[model samples]
Target: MNKLKNKVMLRGALSMLLLAGLGFHSFAQKKNWQNLDLQKDSVFGIDTEKAYEELLKGKKSAPVLVGVLDGGVDINHEDLKRVIWVNKKEKAGNGKDDDKNGYIDDVNGWNFLGSAKGSVSHEALELTRILRRDKAKFENVTAAIVKPADSAAFNQYLKAKIDFEKQTDEAKNAVANIGGLKTVLDSMVKKMGKEKPELADFQNFKAESSIEDRLKRIMVSQLQNSTFEAFYSSQIVKGLEHYQDQLDYNLNPDFDPRPELVGDNYADSQQRNYGSNDVKGPDASHGTHVSGIIAADRTNTIGIQGVADNVMIMGVRAVPDGDERDKDVANSIRYAVANGAKVLNMSFGKGYSWDKKAVDEAVKYAVSKDVLLVQAAGNDNKNLDVEKSFPDRRYEDGGVASSYIVVGASGPNDDKTLKADFSNYGKTTVDVFAPGVQIYSTVPDNKYEAYNGTSMASPVVAGLAALIRSYYPKLTAVQVKEIILKSVVKVNHNVDIEMEEGIAPKSVPFADLCITGGIVNAYEALKLAATYK
Candidate 1:
């Protein structure tokens, strides 16, 4: 789904292969561009170092508990071990409910996708589930003969069918294109007789046919951004595997895994007694990266400095490879809130919702406890005013939720590309922007890499919120959200935006993309936060 940014991610790989581009920034100099100050670095960053140096010089901060609601987190990473949240009241691997919270152990956090045996790594998309359930009733029905009583169901079924077909087709074509490109890369390596070819080795060579020309384009693009060896080894393999997983599991109707894997009653929305205490599930890359961005130990001075210093990261493993169940999301929110989390970073979203009411009640529950909720604005590049991005701040009944902030992705440069081309935006939907493009953070296995998407952006804001709450312990969640929104570095110039892919880009005021009309700045926010107290 576009919410996960997987579709755009695949397209970006293919598009890069098709283009012949040039490098702008060298890898050695871009260690942490996202944390730099805009006035000093000529980029739109949060000015984290400035906040720490100029404002918070020798002040002591109270510890704040923040939750990351995503796939899972590697709490044992080098830079994360000391900062990871630990349930001191419960003992680890006790084989009994130590905290009496219905979950055994309850050490790190809960994993709703786990069972007594193993955990679920992959599942079908929400659209695929819709098609599978409604195919029997609406597959043969015509639009002309549809009754008003079943109008909503029929329309939903038809929309799901169209989207499912289009996504599957895109995945199939991408697989074929990537396969052909791999063949071209291998043949070039053999013909050139070089372990790592240079730009001149392929760009200056004369093409014999269309396939050769395609290979030249691919080589030139790869050589511009990185060494041909790195691109060939990393992106190509990742692209093929990502699309293949979509076909085999995400878009496949017969690939349901909840029955055998989760062992929970699929029909029960209120059943919260399932799941295990395995916080670090099969895939912890996304969650681990987000955790590092939020509160990775700054005192360790090893991998990277997280935005907030005195905050503990609690891992709530609710999201998976595909769409997360609404029950899991609701339970995750309640569990985190009940465990004394002052802020929750929700970095996952979906285009369709199976049960929104359950999720709405959870958000309401969080707000009632004065916990701030930070969410990603999605990566579809579509105007959120007209698009359907599920799990937004808007409740199912009426008004939007309080103490909630929606973040859009911002680039390093404050130019025509200031807004990430893939970030979803709206004049009122998106609350603020944060540095997300090429954001360097920690991944699994004690490693780090740069990842793009609003997923990365959400954690940046969450980290900032945690930073504010740490210093001003008496501030409410709504006050933190207001301070962040009011302290953004506003842009007064006209900027370009592409609402949809393959469409002509439109130039609008920078303020039109979001309500704040600016990107998040920690230095300014902290300066303003002091006055609120």
Candidate 2:
């Protein structure tokens, strides 16, 4: 058993090395491909610009409302401002709930992560919360003492606690290692009397001693594979800071930011109207990017065009910097459905769900209202058929929700590396793949940036669904879902995709990664929508 475990560990380490090498290549490729014309790009993009120019030309399309349930959205973003959803029934800045829909002053949309005073940016991870909430009940208690009804809860608590401890240790170690590397890089840069030293500079610099010579050689070797600007960007520093914050806040069981911010009974799913109206809460980058992907103004030449033209992006802020609560997710879904949103985009997800029943019921309600749901398949790079992801398409009664669509990320290249190394896939669960890696979209404060994730992939599909609903207003949510699934551009060849960080790349049929075995094509989907009865 020990030998087997050691072999598995070695394989895992090799997998990580392979992934790192591939990721470096992917980054360079993204920089080169960003300049391609949107209309003619065949590198995994859905060909939305071509669809508009050809199939959708001179066709009247109804406005479709797409709910973006995420951290928050900058409703006043320049390119996105005109396309934001406005609740006409509710009066803005009034103390009363004018619309009588239980929420007060939800003009732009609702902020379920906020309260009267402020909004929460970070909170405990679900595992940390579970361990904290159940510690007193199960601490030091043996399995023999657990009642038959409490056995499941006890086991859950044990698993959460173990995961929490392991993750916390790993996060701390990563932060320390990154800090050390940054320090060394900073010191080397200072010696060269340059703010951003190049690899050539390090290679030519004479060392004062053997120790200095060894350090210089090491730094030169590391810098050879990456550009100075790309390797030492403010984003990397910010990412390190975020990981530190995760250890200080998310993994700390006693750290509860909700009381000082949201001030809601998080355990109570019945309390519907507790949050504030700050739609553009603390951080709007994630939600704003997602919103722009679905419905940025197509006519505006200032920024990139969105996938769908006639779309009103309804901002439903529910996700925080950490894992979103099941209560907030449920409320966000119901709010979107009740407010005439035809398509809901959920770009955030976590491993554990505290109130899955509530969320499941909310999904059922959305299906009843004929609202289509689009969710990210996650970024764990694991097969969902073996491991579970939250906010999945499975219903509580062991049925599948027809209105739900789960998306996986795909890269620009259509060859063996077409599947994103970070995207999670499942032959049974994932519906389709879309262009997600290095997707350029709107960020907060009218800026644009490229981000990669299944998070980006989900909005791409949501935007396509909105387009289908806009042009074919007669089609129901289920029909639109079917059309998108059936109309994908199938990749018939087998492709190599990473199953995990430390595992060997597996060459599986591209179809086996998703139900449709194809990447989404907006042009094809629009054509199919027109033909569907």
Candidate 3:
């Protein structure tokens, strides 16, 4: 972890030096560049508005159902309510499965993480669970005691234990440090007799001693050109809450928040019909944001317009706050395909997968049903061809799924800083890139916020797939995937990009980062889809 941090810092420094050399203030401005016009503004957006204005004008298309597999979705959000997919077969608020589809009253799609009582907000990491589950069996056992056939499982257990300990300790220390900083800030605010102290207050503060001077300097630097309230609200408060959540729920192996709420046997993959119909579980922010990016109201003049116009978003709540289980992911894919979803957007992934075969089977099922699966290529900034990320395109028998597409995140900047610093990339594993940084989308309660991750990139492609499927209704899922991969706008230049944050920037051919070697373009894809046989 320290090596990774150092690499990130070095990359950041190099990026700063490069920016200074180029006389650019920053690599990219802090605006919604993902929605900008490509040709007119020179921004690397998907040209959604342009496509609608020129290419897709007066074109009649059918509605495409896009399944959003993530941490729930706000079905009733003002920008998303009318665009949500409703189960016409199952009646709403009924106490029975009206459609006889094994799920009861799935009005706005099913919530695999919900229960009759409530839902969970956090969960232990996959490695933490693996460590806890195998502790008693492998506590004092060595290689001599293990059979040759079981050696691989034992090695995996050892690795999981090491990662669990290291990650938990780091999370605890971060929480403590942030909590202490908040205390100091609170004291300073109280002494100033102001809830929101300006930078001038910190500058004018008199330090009677060395300790006071040190504290004053820290506060001044942190709150420079900003109000104390604003700094606390945006940085300290949110940082504290995030680290605390990691310590209390994500890294704690002894904690299990699912037993009481989601009374399903988690170890049993066959027990699928245990969750409730509450698709909007405890946290709907991630799924809502992705859904809004795909199918938010375009003509309402309320929030931002989505990429695809004639689309229905099906909320499949399978991902939790922490790592999602493979069983739920498999079930979510199966459920989406069974319920007539044409495109499925999976915005969540983890490093470890316990049931890869089940997920592979589900992928096969979706492929057979002609459902396109779009996946995020993680945010680790590592090469996905080397490091493993779950729900990948590879099957158990060394065959790749043709219907699946893995997307990396692309930033707003052109040339050198085109790829997002945190996005994972690989020439073989990553299919293409899309705008994922500072993407403004609908959150819960009809609100909007900008979030960054490859999670945001995957849905952009899924929405494009929906657009293609809606307009060219005869194209299969594999055909749509091929069209997207083949019709990318090739960036024919070398660029300096940080494969990992904190590492020094490396100059590589921009085409080597992804298979397509170009960013996904909506207009180009639409044009190509029109000519497809």
Instruction: State every prediction's TM-score relative to the real structure.
Output: 0.95, 0.90, 0.90
lDDT of 2 by residue, 1-533 (tens): 00001111112221122224221332444332322323465456787777888899999999999999988899889999999999999888877799899999999899998788899887788888899889999998989889899998899898888888887876676577556556655676788898877888889777775545655665565577665666556324654676687798778888998877888887788778888889989888889988888888988778878889999998998888778888989999999999999999998777777888899989999999999999988877778999867887797678888899999988887788888877889999899998778788898999987777788888989999999999999999999999999988899888887654456888999999999999888888988898988
> After superposing candidate 1, which stretches have Cα over 4 Å from the reference?
2-8, 13-29, 143-149, 198-200, 203-206, 499-503
Q: Against the true structure, what is every candidate's RMSD? A: 2.3, 5.3, 4.9
Candidate 3 structure quality by residue, lDDT tens digits, 263-374: 8888887676878888888878889989988888887989888889999999998888788888889999999999999999998777777888889989999999999999
Clashing pairs in 1: none
Model 1 agreement with the true structure over 1-533: per-residue lDDT tens digits: 52354544554555345443322232333657777898898777899989999999999899999999989999899989999899998999878887788888889888999888889889788889888988998989998998889898899889889999998998888788778778776787778888788988987767766777777865675576678766765667878888889899999999998889789987788888788888889999889988988887899869998999999999998888888878889999999999999999998888888788999999999999999999999887888988888887899789989999999998887788888878889998999999888778888889997777899899999999999999998999999999999999998887778644456789888899999999999999999999984
The 10-residue segment with the lowest total lDDT in model 3 = 1-10
Best candidate according to TM-score:
1
| lDDT at residue 302 of model 2 (Cα atoms) | 84
Error of 3 at 452 (Å): 0.8
lDDT for position 403 in model 2: 96
